[model samples]
Target: MKATTTSAIVLAGGLGTRLRSAVPDLPKPMAPVAGRPFLAHLLDRWIDQGITHFVLSVGYRHEVIRAYFGGTYGGATLDYAVEATPQGTGGGLLLAAQHLPADAPFLLLNGDTFFDVPLSQLTELAASQQTDWCFALFRTSEPGRYMGMEIAQDSRITNLRTGMEQPERLANGGVYIVHPRSLSGLAAQPDTPLSLENDLFPRLLAAGQRWFGLECPGAFIDIGIPQDFHRAASVLPVHTAQRTEDALHH
Candidate 1:
C-alpha cells in the first residue's frame, strides 16, 4: 500500500428515519451542530487522519451535502456516489467503492457518527499481509441500540450478536478499513441492499478470512436516534463522545 493512499468511502446514504423528528428538513449528516452541518465535523475527523480523498455515498437529499460541502472539504477532495434509490449500508458502500482505487484499502465511516479513533491505525492493520477487513470496537451499555460484536483473544471476530437481551458487549463503532477486493461478492451485484453488520460482516466471519477489530477507547457517538441526537447537540460543541463506558442503555 502506498503511503499517499488516504482515500475513504463514507456511507452517507441512510434516510435517518429515526432522526427525522429532530432534523426534519435535511439529511442526518446535514443536521445542524455547532452552527454547521454534522458532516463537516466528521470530515474534519477523517481529514485529520491523513485522508486526502473521500467518496461519499448519498441518497435521501444528497443535494444538501453537495450544495453545502460542494467539491472540497478540509483540504481533502470530495466526491459522491449519488444513489437514485435507497440502498442499505453495504450496497451504498459498494456503490462508493467504484469511485476508489482498486488496489488501496479505504477507510469507511458512518456519516452520522463519530468515533475519535486513529484512522491511520486501522489502515496500518489493513496493510498487513493477512489483514483484509479491520474495524474499531467501542464499549457501550446500550448494545441493543447498536450492533453487538465479540472479538476473540486473537482479535478475530467470533460473532456479531443482535438483540437487547445480551450481556455487556462491544458495539460496532461504525468505523472501518475495508479493501475493495475483500467485498467482491457484494460488489458484483449492486442495488440488492446489504448491511455491513447484518450481512457483510457475517459472510466475512464465516469465510474464516483475515478480519480484526481494534479496541478503540475514546469519544464515540452515533446520532441515529432522537435521544442520542439531542444528547449530541449539547455535547458535540465542547467534546466528542468520549466516555469510559456508556451505561445509559439508550
Candidate 2:
C-alpha cells in the first residue's frame, strides 16, 4: 500500500551564526540564492514533487520569512510554528509536527541546506521497508561536519554521531520521511532545546525502532558555515535548473 503522508515539515528556525556576516538580519532560509530566497527554491521543488502542504518551524527573526511567503506559495499551503527561544532542531520539529495528521508520515528538511532527492522514490522505499522513518544519506569524506550514520546490511540505521572517522561513513542528508509516531516518544518538551542528532535519534536507536538510511546523492550543499554559504550561490543555480528540467521531462 502507498504511504498516507502528503505533507512535509521544514526546519526553518536556526540562527545562522556562521553566515551572519554575509546574511545579517535574516533567517538562513531567507538567504538569497540566485536572486531568490533559498527556501523558495526548496518549496518550488517540493511543489513539483506534488507536495501541497508544508509546516515551517520558524524562529530567530522569523517575521522575515513570514513576510516573504505568507499563507501560501505557488499553490502550496503554508503553515508556521513559532518558537519563542532557541529550541534546537528536535524541539522545533516536534512542535511543528503537531500540525500533521496523527496517522500519517510527513517529510522533513533542513532550512539551511539542499539535497536533490527524489521525494516520491524515498517514500516508496520507506513503505517497502515498513519502517517508521527513513533518512537520506550521502557518501561524504567530512562526516565530522555532517553527522555520520552506519547503515546495516538490512538497510537499517545502526549508529550516528558527529566526528565519525574516515571512509565508509554516510553523511546525514538532512531530509526525512517520518511517521508521527516515530517522534511521539521524544524525550524533550517544547520549551527545551533538543537536538535530533545528539539526543532524540540515539534514543530511537536504543529503543530499536525500525528506521533506515537511504544512500541518496545529488546537488547537496548547506549554508550553515561561511564557506558553504558563499559557495551555495554558485552551486544551487545548477541544481535548481536541473530540478526544473527534470520536473518538466517527467
Candidate 3:
C-alpha cells in the first residue's frame, strides 16, 4: 500500500543544550552528520517515502535552518513555522499545523531523531483502524530515556510511562501519523509550552482518544546527546542509503 499522507510536520526547534559542547553553532537538526546537515538526511528519507510537503516547526537558531533549506529540498515543498519564543514540541507542532489543511492526516517526526519506519504502513494502520493517531514504536530495554507505551492486543495504546518504570517495553519512536482533528483542542492552548511526549499525548490518551501503536523494524537514532550525535556520522549515511535501496526494490 502507498502512503496517502504526504505532508509532514518536523519538530526541529530543540535547543540542543546537551550537544552544545559538540555542535555549538547549528540547531540540533542541522548538526552535521556524514558531511551533510542531519536534517538533510531526515528529509531525504522522508521524501523518498513520498512526503512532498514539510512544515518545519523551528526555533532557537531557526534562521540557520531557514537560510540553508529555503522553500524546498529533495523535491519537497518546505514551509516554516517560526516560533517567536521557544515553544516546546507540542506547541511547535500546533503552530506548524496551521500551515496544513484542516482535515488531512500527516506524519510527525522529531528532527533530532531518525526512525526508518515505513510511512506507508503507518498510514495503512491509521486508515484500517480509522484512528486519529498511530505511533511507530520500537522495543527498548532502556525505557528510562524514552516514553514507554503499553499497547493492547488490538494495538490501541492503553498506557504511558515516563521512565524505566517499564523496562524492556515498546517505546515511542518519535514518528507518527496524526490527523489534525485529533490535535484541534491543543490549538486553544497556543501560549502554553506543551511537550508532545510529556504533556499533550498523555492528555489525549486520558481523554480516550483513538490512539494506536505499531512496532517497527528499522534503524532508530536520536542525536540528542553527544554520543549519539557522533554515532550518527557513521550510522545515518549507510542506513539512509540502505533505505533508498530498500525503497527501490520494493
Candidate 4:
C-alpha cells in the first residue's frame, strides 16, 4: 500500500548567521529566492506532492514569516510554532511536531535547504522497511560539507558521521519521513540547544532504532551562504518550470 503521510514540519527557526550580510533582518527561510520567500518555494513543492497541512517552526524574526504567509498558502493550512528564544534544530522540530496528528508518519524538512525528493517514494520506503525514520539521501562529491550516511545493502543506515572526505557518498538531504513514535522519549530541555543531526539522530542510532536511507537523484540546493543564496534566484525558477513540465508530460 502507498503510505499516507500528508503532514509536514519545517525547521525555519535558524539564526541565519552565515547569511546575515545578505539577509540582514530576515530569518534564513524568509530570504528571498526568485522574488518570494524561500519557504514559499519549499511549500509549493510539498503542496504539489499533496501535503495539506504544515507546521513551521519559526524563530529569529519569525514575525516576518508569520506576517507574510499568515494562516494559509497555496491552499494548504499553515500553522506556526514560535520560539521565544533560540532553540536548536531538534528542539524546533519537536516543538512543531506537536501540531501533527498523533498516529501517522509525517514529513520533516530543513527550511534553508531544498531537496526535491518525492514524498511518495520516501513514505513507501518507510512502510516497506517499517522504519522509525526514513531519510532522503543524495549523492555529493564534495564531502565534509554535509552529514555522511552509511547504508547496508538492505537499506539500513549503519553509520553517520559529521564529515566524510570520501567522494560520491550518500549525504543527508534534509528531508525525512518519521513515525510519531520515534519522538517518544525526546523532549526539549529549557535553554539547551538540541541539534537533530549532531545530537538526537546519533543517540537514536545508538539505541538501535529502525533508521533507513533511501537515495534520491533529485536537484538539491542550500541557500545558507551568500553565493548559494544568489544562485537560488536562478536555480529555483528553472527547477519550478522543469517540475511543472514533468508533471504535464507525466
Candidate 5:
C-alpha cells in the first residue's frame, strides 16, 4: 500500500499518571520532549513516510492537544476522537475507527513510546502477511519491565505475555499496523475498558490468527516516567539521526 493511502491512529488518550509530575498540565502527547511537544517529532517522522491523515485519540486535558495541533500540523490532516471516559489501548483505537478507511490498513502508535522503525517497511510487511495485525517488537537489553512476545522460527508471533510473564521476555514496542477487519468485534462490549495487550492479542493468538512482528534495531525510548522522559530528551539528537538515516534509505 502507498504511504498516502495508509492512515495513522495515534493512541494519545492515556492519563499519564506516571509522568504527571513533569507534565501535570497537559496530555502526554503535548508534553515537551526537547523544546517542542513529543507529537511534533512523531508527526515529522510519519510525514517522511508519506502519511497524511491522522486520528488523535484524546482524553484528559485533551483541549491542550487540540489547541496546539488544531486541524493539521505541517501537511498532515488531523482529526480528533475524544474519550469521555478513560479507555485502554484497544478501546481508544475502536473509538477512532470511524475516521479510518475501511479498505486500507492503518498505523497505530502509543503517544508515550518512540522508536525509529521505517513505517513504509512495516506497511509492506503487513500487506504481504495478509494477516489481521502486525506489531513492531524491540529487543531491549532489559525486558524486565515490558510485555513480551514469543515468536516462532518463521517470525510468526506464537504467544504473548501477561501478568508476571511479561517481564520475563522480549518487550513489546508500542507500534502496530492494524487491519480494519481485525477489530470487528471490539465495540460489542462498550462499558469495559479492554486492553490490546492484555485482552485482545491473546484472544487473537488463541483463534489461530497470525500476527507478524518487526524487530527494530534503531534507538527506542519510552517517556512514560520522569527518568525515561529525561533520558529521551537528552538523547533527542540520537533519535533524530536514526530517523534521518532510515528516511534516506527509504
Candidate 6:
C-alpha cells in the first residue's frame, strides 16, 4: 500500500510561564530563537519533508500566533484550533482530532522542543512497525530532568516515566506519529487535565497497544527554560548550516 499524506498538529497552547521573563509578550511557540519565531524553524524542516497541512492548537496569546503566521507559511496551509481554556497535551490533541482523518496517521509535536529527526524516516518507521503509536526517543546526555521512555529489546515502548519497568536508556523526544484509532478511547472530561504521557499512554500499554520508539540522533533541545532557550538558539544556527550542507551534497 502507498504511504498516506501526513498532516501535523503542533500543540502551541501553553502559557509559557517558565520563559515569561524572556518572552512576555508572545506565546511560547511564537518566542524568538535565532532571529525568527521558533516554530518557523520546525515548519521549515517539516515542509522540506513534504508536509503540506498544519493544525496549530493555540490557547494563550493565540491571536499573536495567527497574526504572525496567517493562513499559510512557505506554501503549507495552516489551520487553527483555539482552546478557550488551558488544556493538557491530550486534551489539545482531542480538540484537534476533528481536523484529522480517522483512517490516516498524523504527526503531533510539542511546541517547545526541537527534535531534528528526519521526518521521512520517522514516518517510514511508524508505518513499517505497523504500530498504533510511535514516539521519537532521544538519548540525552542528562536524562534526569526529562520524561523518560523505557523500551524493550524488541523496540516497543514498555512504559513512560511513571511506570516501574526498566529497559534501555532513552528519553521522550516529544514528537509522535499517531494512528487516529489509537485515540478512540480518549474522552474529554470536565475538570481534569489529561496528559498523553501520564494518562493515555499508560492505559494504552496496559491494553497492549503497539507503541514504538524511534531514536533521534539529531539535536533535541527544549526551549522551556531560560538557559535551554539560550542553548537552543546557539545550537540551531550550526544545526541548520550542517543540514544545508548535507542537502547540497545529497
Question: What does each candidate score in C-alpha RMSD?
Answer: 6.6, 4.3, 4.4, 4.4, 5.0, 5.0
Better of 2 and 3 by TM-score: 3
lDDT of each: 0.77, 0.82, 0.86, 0.87, 0.77, 0.80
Model 6, residue 235: distance off in Å is: 2.0
Give the top-scoring candidate (lDDT).
4
> Candidate 2 or 5, higher TM-score?
2
**lDDT by residue for model 3 (1-250), tens:** 5669999999999899999999998899989887678888899889888999999999999988987788877668999999888789988999999999999899999999999998888899999897888999998887489988888999999998778555488999999999888987666254678788888888888888899999998988999999989988666645435333223322
lDDT of 6 by residue, 136-232 (tens): 8887546356678878887888877742234445888889888898888676553776777777777887988889988888888889988898777
User: Candidate 6, overall lDDT?
Assistant: 0.80
* Whole-structure CA lDDT of model 5: 0.77
Candidate 4 local accuracy as lDDT? Answer: 0.87
Best by TM-score: 4
- Report how far off residue 90 is in candidate 1 (Å): 0.9
Q: Compared with the true structure, what per-residue lDDT tens digits does model 1 show for residues 1-250?
A: 4444488888898999999998898999988776667787787776766888999999999987888777776678899998877778878888899898787777888999988887666666667634677888888776368777777887767777876456567878888887777877667245477887788778877887777888888787789888887777565535354221111211
Q: Clashing pairs in model 5?
A: none
Put down candidate 5 lDDT per residue, 163-217, tens digits, no spaces: 3333345567888888888776658245788687777777777887768888877
| TM-score list, all predictions | 0.88, 0.91, 0.92, 0.93, 0.88, 0.88
Question: What are the clashing pairs of model 1?
Answer: 219-241, 219-242
Candidate 3 accuracy as TM-score: 0.92
> Per the 3 Å backbone cut-off, how many clashing residue pairs does candidate 5 have?
0
- Predicted candidate 3: what Cα RMSD to the true structure? 4.4
Which residue runs does candidate 3 get wrong by more than 4 Å? Answer: 165-167, 188-191, 237-250
